[model samples]
Target: MGRKVEEVVEVLVEPIANRNGLELVDIEYSKEGQDWILRVFIDKKEGVSLDDCQSVSRELSDILDKKDPIDKTYLLEVSSPGIDRPLKKDEDFIRFSGRKVDISTYAPINGEKKLNGELLGIDEGNIKLVVDGEELNIPREKVSQARLAVEF
Candidate 1:
């Protein structure tokens, strides 16, 4: 059910994001406590502004109202993915190469399930990372989640 909602919202939101000169990074539909939240993460080269989120929210709100895709009540949230953004697509892996990243695998790789290192990018169905001066090539399918690691 959640996956279906995400798919439906993605189809409805992509055009609006493109028209607004924004990249649709990800869409999430999940229950938090008693409420369902529909989160839309967007990005742009110049970075996303509050106005961008507001505009997308307004337009998307109207579209969702008319389309009425979801059967239950959910709060819609439109915002930037932020510095520690998720790395979802292959393009994201290439685009964020050389950046620090945190990755979790569905199963242990080298006896570790969580890895934090410099992203060496994706190559030939693998996600390459350099951890402690050692390069590790993790099969893309094994990665459960990957995101930029916040550095302070």
Candidate 2:
């Protein structure tokens, strides 16, 4: 059900983002406590502003109201993917190469499930990383989540 909602929202929102000169980073449909929340994450090369979020939210809200894709009520949220933004698509991996990242695998890789390192980018269906001067090649399918690592 959650996956279906995300798909529907993605379809509905992608065009709006593109029209607004923003990249649709990700769409999340999940239950938090007693409420279901639909989160839309957007980005742009110049970075996203509050105006960008508000405009996208207003447009999406109207469309969702008319489409009525979800059966139950849910809170709609539109925002920027912050400093530690998620790396969702293959393009993201390539684009963020050389940046610090945190990646989690569905199963252990080299006896570790969580890895934090410099992203060397994707190569041959694998995510390459440099950890402690050692390089590791993790199969892309094994990665459960990958996101930029916040460095202070």
Candidate 3:
């Protein structure tokens, strides 16, 4: 059910995002208190604004009402992914080159699963990360999840 909801949301939101010049970073439908909460994360080169969120919310809400993909009542939230945006695709790795990132792998590579360092970017066939004075080329297939690490 959850998976279906995600798929449907993507199908519905992609056009809206494209029309508004925003990237649909992620979507979540989860329980909070007694209600199900739906959140859609958006981003752009200049960052998203409250007006963007409100516009998306209004338009998407109307579509959701008409389509009724989700039968249950839920509160909808449309917002930005913020500074710690997820690195979901290979393109993200290329786009965030030279940025600091934290990544986890499906299994240990060189005896570790978690790696935090500067991302040099995606090369022809690998993800290059500089860790501990050494650069490790982690193949994209091995990465489980990655996100920009907020450096304080």
Q: Across residues 110-140, which tens digit of lDDT does each residue of candidate 1 receive?
A: 8999999999899999999999999999999
User: How many pairs collide in each candidate, listed in order?
Assistant: 0, 0, 0
Write the residue-wise lDDT of candidate 2 on 1-152 in tens digits.
Answer: 99999998999999999999999999999999999999999999999999999999999999999999999989999999999999989899999999999999999998999999999999888999998899999999999999999999
Cα deviation of 80, candidate 1, in Å: 0.8
Off by more than 4 A, model 2: none
lDDT tens digits, residue span 1-152, model 3: 77779889989998999999999998889888998989999999998999999999999999999999998999999999989899887788889999999999998978999999999998876889999879999988999889999999
In angstroms, give how far residue 29 of model 3 lies from its true place. 1.9
Determine the C-alpha RMSD for candidate 3 after optimal superposition of all C-alphas.
Answer: 1.7
- Off-target runs (Cα >4 Å) in candidate 1 are none
TM, every model: 0.97, 0.97, 0.90
Residue 4 of model 3, lDDT score: 79
| lDDT of predicted model 2 | 0.96
Candidate 3 — what's its lDDT? 0.91
The candidate scoring highest on lDDT is 1
